[model samples]
Target: MNRFALCYFLLCVSSAATAQDKEVQAIRTRYQETAKKVQLLEQDPQNAALYVHRISLNDKGTPWPAVGNYKKTIKFYFELGDEQVHTLVRIDITSESAAHQYATEYLFDAKGQLVFCYDRMPDGQSPENNIEVRYYFSGDKPIRRTEGKTISDKPSPEQQPQAKRLQSDAAELQSLFKAIDK
Candidate 1:
């Protein structure tokens, strides 16, 4: 309305764009440095699941580290509403931590565009502590937001992270899941 108000709005919009560009470039740089990761993305699709994760706390407002980012990956499988195959690949990140007491999950379409995002609770408070991401995309480009199903139960003791027991346990679980999913 007023000239001062309009100027303020424009500055805010410009600053936001700059911040987003920086974030994307930082991620791309990380990908470049890890050439092996890029190679895997080109080669083994399954193993490329490694890139499916990253860590980032939301600071879009307020100070840095006000939130906590637990896990992220560049590759994930999705089966929604009887889809024939995994419809979208994502670079997923979660911002949830004990200290901040906030959690957010985002799904970027394969082409690295935000398709849909679940901020805090999209529909309502989830029954569990974990956040669920549900989004749609056209090929690699994003289509729109979608309903998300979540795991209400807590992670099992075996699922808890352990320094030494992780590898063997993960391998064993992966085998079990393979058999069961089949």
Candidate 2:
């Protein structure tokens, strides 16, 4: 009777695990199906130029500490045989009080989709405070991962200032694209 009870317990445990696996697999399938329905965007040169123009304007409007306190550079790359353009922005800000460099790269697909982005910024006095994020997108949905750190819990709004800035930047970029599309 004891041996029979142990076997039954093992079987039940295995069955529960198998059921959970099936549920996870089902969810993954649904996610993939939804992602497939998200259409890839086409590349538009005129629109792309407009996007660059608008972002450049915003970057220019960033208040520097002084007239000679900052330097800004923008570079664009077009992929061969792919309808993709990549833009890299570098801003070096120096103040008598402090100095830091901020850089971000944006990748847009042929379909005017912002497919990937990497943003890097200085964290307080500690190099560890430096925040870097790389985001991958399928259409408008973002899959994001941060390098060099882990968080035990979800960050509160106050703890996510950089993310908020990036989100705002992405929104502006999207609006520029939409304006050109119209």
TM-score, one value per model: 0.25, 0.42
Global CA lDDT computed for model 1: 0.39
Candidate 2: minimum summed lDDT over ten consecutive residues — where? 88-97
Clashing pairs in 2: 41-111, 42-110, 42-111, 43-110, 43-111, 123-129
lDDT (Cα, tens digit) per residue for candidate 2, span 8-121: 999998997676456435434533442332211124454332223222423444555554345455433332233544322211122221356667756555554555556777
Off by over 4 Å in 1: 36-182
lDDT of 1 by residue, 36-81 (tens): 5546756885666333322233444334364334332222333222
Residue 129, candidate 2: alpha-carbon lDDT: 61
Q: Candidate 2: RMSD over Cα atoms?
A: 10.8
Candidate 1 residue 101 C-alpha distance from true site, Å: 42
Off by over 4 Å in 2: 1-68, 79-98, 126-129, 149-167, 171-182
Location of the lowest summed lDDT over 10 successive residues in candidate 1: 72-81
Q: Residue 113: error of model 2 in Å? A: 0.9
